[model samples]
Target: MRSAPRTEHVVQEAYVMSRDYIRYVTGRAAKAAPTVTAAALRHAGDDLLAKYPIFFKRWPRVFKAISSDNACDYLFNILDQHFQPDKPWQKKELTWSGILSIYVLAGQLAIHCQSHGMECVLEELEVRVGEYMEAKVCPGIREKGGWSGFVERYAEKEEPERAAVRACCGVLLLLASISLTYYMYRRLR
Candidate 1:
């Protein structure tokens, strides 16, 4: 008899592949932004979704729900609420803060899925990506520089690479917490 493929193997493979693709696409998209404008981020997201139709088709309902204006507004509000800075330094801080917020939210989604015994489907990933972009680019009203310069300064001076790594670690911690919570939930049942 043929042996069935392990579910864990499938999950791990999918997670790594998807994460790498997301990082690549996001970096390119971020670099492509004309300015730190909401329209720019939305356009980039449109580009990403256009490139990955199969992923969106997998969870049509979730995609539809997330694509709504309200969903976008909610994500925008979250970023505005958390990362709003009164001073110039605070405005600069928004870059890292926004990125970290998305990582935390993605980790939360993972936790929600684990608790419900649901796989992290493509729709969930799409929504998470959208949320990340919306948070990162929507708030700044003033245009200090063009997109290329902004990306360079943010990437080099701000050290977004380091911040991203730290955010990934934070996501892992959130995952561990989810696993622990799920264990407790299961035991209690």
Candidate 2:
């Protein structure tokens, strides 16, 4: 017989987010504004998820506590690696590969969140990418002359995170629809 789908909380995979970390996070948020507290929680949760993506699923509180800006900071590091000033990637306008990477990141983020009945905002995804661009890409570009001031040139354009998140959501919806239809068909058959 096929095993029934799990509806209960599953133990998260192992990660380094110790109880002390959670205590520290909660303690820090105790006096902050709601937005600030949420941001901090989101950052903490994002860090935990990034460091231990598999383990993050177990902590329901993290999802409930995070701010809107916590779409996928996990992917930022990888993005930085790809677009760093020295990487072989062309330093002209943002390439399709870069955009595709964002889509993949958003896709993965959605998969993880949706699997746990959570949702994230497109702005959240955008903000994380923008933050990464400012923090890493801009500084790097300024320090070493990149392909003719790429950061300054495209500062207004912003990271293509929204489009990626949209694409991911679309793909996710498509997949979910297909799954649901398939399940219904099987059941009715």
Over 1-189, each residue of candidate 1 has an lDDT whose tens digit, in order, gives 212222333222223323433433334223343323323333334444567767545433442334322443444455566666677565555353344334434433333333444343424554544434433442331232223432343332346889999999999999999999999999999
The number of the candidate with the highest lDDT is 1
lDDT score of residue 13 within candidate 1: 28
Backbone clash numbers for all candidates listed = 0, 0
Model 2, 9-115: lDDT tens digits are 11010001111122233342234323322233334344445767765455444344434354465455556666666646756445423432343344345444555
- List CA RMSD, all candidates: 21.9, 21.3
lDDT of each: 0.43, 0.42
Give the backbone clash total of model 1: 0
Distance from true position, residue 107, model 1, in Å?
2.4
lDDT of 2 at 146: 33
Task: Show where candidate 1 strays beyond 4 Å.
Answer: 1-80, 84-93, 120-122, 135-189
* Model 2 misplaced regions, further than 4 Å: 1-71, 87-94, 120-123, 126-189
Q: What lDDT, from 0 to 1, does candidate 1 have?
A: 0.43
